[model samples]
Target: MLRLVLAVLFSGALSLPASADVSIKRLFGKEQRALNAIPQTHLVSLLERSKAAKVSSGGITYSRDWLAGQPKQSGGREWRCLAEALYFEARGESVKGQFAVAEVILNRVSSASYPDTICGVVHQGTGRKYACQFTYTCDGHAEVIAEPRAFERVGKIAKLTMKSAKRPLTKGATHYHTKAVSPYWADKFPRTATIGFHHFYKQPSRLSRN
Candidate 1:
């Protein structure tokens, strides 16, 4: 029976859609005894170690030493877009602020209402007056990437953010504005948190609209 259940679990895991959470959990339930044999704290530690390894391998250790280390080569176009957005938008803000901005950009990408790609989300409404999502993209000033250190720092942040699928800082926020200015849209959304120079918000639910 155990062998048969193990076979079913493996087969179900392989056959089901990767995003099918329910089916995956159902299959996992079949092996609960085996999984439960591992210590919970040990499992959590292993997961943490795996996440740290991914962060380290991407040349972002989430530390000053790593940021001060020799910069890795600039990544591909998607990475370049995200890094540029962060550099221009939040370079002067605290590191946590930069991450928060990056998180909002990424959260927008994942959201149904916004573009699914980073560059698309970052550069949305490029030519329209007072219509761009990110101010730097449409401010009409040449985007001269003059600050090498700042660019390098944000590039690493972007790389790590894309590689790690978790967004811990923003609490599912998809929008933000600097403390210097309050946008009208901010009042409609639920304020999530304030980090550094920026204020974050999550989209309001359908019930909230009514």
Candidate 2:
């Protein structure tokens, strides 16, 4: 089942149509609208980076060494937003934790309750005081990526996570907070996974009984 799913996604990723302008916008825009209009060049850049990491039969090994070996990665606006979020929020976390945080952002993109794009989800409530999805966005401090190596590590993770098939690492979690403090919403959302220093949660379903 997993291989079949991976095959389908891989096929889709490689199925660029013959055209003068081959681009992710042409290939996946209809399906992955949450990515918004990713520039053609950014998609090509990601594909180039993917070539450096040969697929292993044993599957992904989450470690700094593994991430370091992957080619340095960058992408358009959406990818930058996700990469920055991981750098700020989960740089200190284990590889799995970093992926888990990325999962939350992606989950929010999938959910109707939040914005449809990665940048939109990451900066959902910016501008007003105390109204942002990610603290780094609204925390008043500049989003300075001072640590180039850490940024590169998270950038690679962001690249892979964006391409990864929807996995159960966070079990569909859309929210999370470090274990140090409990937010008011923590008690309300169902806790899904506890990984590293974060506790992940899935927002309650909003189905209405008529």
Candidate 3:
């Protein structure tokens, strides 16, 4: 089942041209070949376009057919920030790992210890040697967005997650480390799961100050 889910996610993030639309019609259904594919509006449009909906021409007030449980695209600024960070930091990561990375950032966003917003979470401690949440921000080189393709892929994932798509891949992990880093925090948190080049960990909840 894990491999199956991973396969589906990887297929969603598969290589496509920068202008190519990566959408639900491409991933989930086939009828709506050229539907409007905005992350926030696509799903709603998708249901309207597909035959699965029960649109009535017979007239009943002014109501459109609704899907029971369709996934919505995320449009909030926090979702965008999370997407940008994932794109910049983990575009090379596997699909499962990409979501896990986003989870860590979101976890930090909700934690009392870190910033409450995605931009704040990603840009925390700027200018200092190792200040930014994303190392690329503080690294010597400018954060050049050369790969529009990769960024779009990450953006879609962020949109989906922000819309309440559940990713149970990580075990509520707020931290992760690549196989290369051996930080002091590693031993402090319990190891949760390993996906691709990253290791997920959950920290002890011993803090009293809120």
Best by lDDT: 2
After the best TM-score superposition of candidate 3, give how far the Cα of residue 186 lies from its true spot, in angstroms.
0.6
Q: What is the C-alpha RMSD of each candidate to the true structure, in Å?
A: 15.1, 18.3, 15.0
- Ordering by TM-score: 2, 1, 3
Arranged by lDDT, best first: 2, 1, 3
- How far residue 196's Cα lies from its native spot in candidate 3, in Å, is 0.8
Please provide, for model 2 over 1-210, each residue's C-alpha lDDT reduced to its tens digit, 9 standing for 90 to 100.
Answer: 223444586577665555623464454445465344667656544443443333343255566556777889989999999999999999988777898899999998888888899999988888878788788988889989899988989999898888877655889999899999999888888899998899999998873110
Better-scoring candidate (lDDT), 2 or 3: 2
State how far residue 69 of model 3 sits from its true place (Å).
18
Q: Which segments of candidate 2 are over 4 A away from where they belong?
A: 1-58, 207-210
- Per-residue lDDT tens digits for candidate 3, residues 74-124, read 466787778778877788775556767887777777678778888887888
- Give candidate 3's root-mean-square deviation (CA, Å): 15.0
Candidate 1 residue pairs in clash (backbone atoms < 3 Å): none
Which numbered prediction scores highest in TM-score against the true structure? Answer: 2
Model 1 residue runs over 4 Å out of place are 1-63, 70-73, 207-210
Let me know the TM-score candidate 3 reaches against the reference structure.
0.61
Model 2 Cα RMSD, Å?
18.3
